[model samples]
Target: MNILTAMSSRLTVPFLDLKSQYRQHQAAFDGAMGAVIAEAAFAGGPWVERFEAEFAAYCGTTYAVGVANGTVALWMVLLAMGIGPGDEVITVPSSFIATAEAISFCGAKPVFVDIQEADCNMDPGLLKAAISSRTKAIIPVHLFGHPANMEAILAIAQEHGLPVVEDAAQAHGARYDGKMAGSMGLAGCFSFHPVKNLGAFGEAGAVITNDGELAQKLQRLRDHGQFEKYQHEVIGWNGRMDGLQAAVLSTKLPFLEERNAQRRQRAGWYFEQLGGIPDLVLPASLPEVEHAWHQFPVRIPCRDAVFAAMQGAGIGCSIHYPVPIHRQKAYHFLGLPEGSFPVAERCSREFLSLPIFPELTEEQVRTVTRVLKLWITRNHRVKNIAFSGKLAV
Candidate 1:
């Protein structure tokens, strides 16, 4: 290929850098994999057990049960809470579909709530209005690694006698009032998908809790209802995490704090560089909360045009969810029409997530922020200025 072609090929940046990550822990990861393989304990074995224990400790929880993936971890938590048929799980619609899907899997309805405008998390102010006798639990997803207003949510949950299941999939180390994301709820679910802060080689997840009985129930729920082999007591699904994935996770676990710190640092750089860019709204941090920086998402006007320009510029910008869960075809049966969730729908159309990973260098962060600012200002500045003038009139 010519230099031009090579340059064009190199222009595209990945949203996450698995290569740099593996390179950083090549020897340890390889050794952990080798150990798991040599032990021939591939399923629900010693390695997985060790990983779960370590992860629970990391999350500051008493128990952690490894599952096949984030979705299963969520489902298991709801099920173990005895939440099923004729129940409703209240959650925000701005998050990944898995948050609602897990509730639906248990024959429960998902009550969509609006998010706080700045953080794109479930707005605590909207919680009370959504509560009903059918509301068995509240699942607040720490969207984009910013911890939700858990203090308010917990107070509401306590008042309503609702169990709180945290979707901590995007927030591994985020803190609210000094309490870790997972540790704030009755149970918290985490995803070890490759893009997450503590991502594994493949799919892995865990359900964490301080409640011993709830933890035991979730363990059985993940292991085909058998605490011991052939002693199945309840109908359960085989959602155990793979030994290989657990081994990889164990190898990477110690680096999670450092990785999250780097992500925060990169986000700070983006904030500093992109803070004053017209038409671009950066993510916000509350005075009492610390965001894990899972994704440095921002909302901007002319989102579609800005997205196109970024893609054309060979930048790796993407939307977390361009469509809200209420608008998804699978949930159409719920009968929520367009604009039913105005805030979430608006968020879907306007929010964009720039590339964020600990492996991203300062140069890459600057490049992404620079491209985004240039695109938005170039395309929309005239209209925005005109609108401002009109508002003055």
Candidate 2:
């Protein structure tokens, strides 16, 4: 059968392949989880400590604080940095709103900056223009598993005496210039959302840093501000990562590098297959960075039409962010116009994420690419017919 007929025979192909991942690691995962349950160490216990240490070592950092989730991870980092009311944090507009929401939750303003068209990470060139005396820190997101331009961002932060925080929620096991994403800044935040490269059964997250003092502060911050029981010293939040999630994460940690490697291989196939398609822009890999491929998003002209075509063809495809954060209703007070952040706005319209989990087969990759190319060609034909007297595609 042709690619379209083959896809149409199926009902729904998932955008992610979580079940395959779990099946591959079931024995070890079950044993670790059982151990956590048997110990009855549900919160802030030995398992949590063990996972924190292991994750810290994995990230090449001195300390890692397990938290409730990625959002809390960002919140705890911002709080630890002493960012508060009237302060502003600079970040890109192309991220999950959690990056901006974390700043707003801390009673600080999230100053929006545009992104580089290449990787959708923050454009460091625009960062300098956005900084003010109230700018307390820079939270650069490693969007879609690609590392931000950290070297330039780090240099700018160091020159201005600003602390750099990494929003590494989607970039587990991703590295920049031989250093891991979470270790590239003063503090790096990670998420164990089930969809990420290194995921937990449920919600979980952590903060990693080389600064010992900051590490202790985050520990206190997550646990009611008390190093000891019932001695509340400062305002804090209940953001501790449960031992159960820690156990799951620990079981999954050792395989992170291998899984990310598989993802890269899959991404390579997608690029190789679809890179030359007309009006389609494949994500670029930079020389200094290793992509985790948490998402293998492609930018195509008339993205919505292509999305509808893929869905009609029974291939699951989705957009990473249909609306840029700055343009969202919650952030409308920023009063940014339609073309305010051109790169981010354009990207939101054009980018669509494809199925790229490690477990996906080469056949599946070919299937997706074939469907996408066919759809794009058909759409181009329709456009040409409507505009000109001749048929095209």
Backbone clashes per model, in order?
Answer: 0, 0
- How do the residues 1-393 of candidate 2 rate in per-residue lDDT, one tens digit apiece? 334545677745678878887798789888998998999999889999999999999999999999999999998899888999999999989999999999999999999899998788999999899999999999999999999999999999998999999999999989999999989899999999999999999999999999999999999999999999999999887899999999989888999999999999999999789867778989978999999999988998778867876776678898989999999999999888899899999999999999989888898888888888877676675764432211222
TM-score for candidate 1 = 0.94
Top candidate (TM-score): 2
Model 2, global lDDT: 0.89
RMSD of each: 4.5, 2.7
Q: Residue 322, candidate 2: how far off, in angstroms?
A: 0.5
- Candidate 1: tens digits of C-alpha lDDT, residues 76-145: 8998888889999999988999999999999999999999886788999999999998999999999899
Clash pairs, candidate 2, are: none
TM-score of every candidate relative to the true structure: 0.94, 0.96
Judging by lDDT against the true structure, name the best candidate: 2
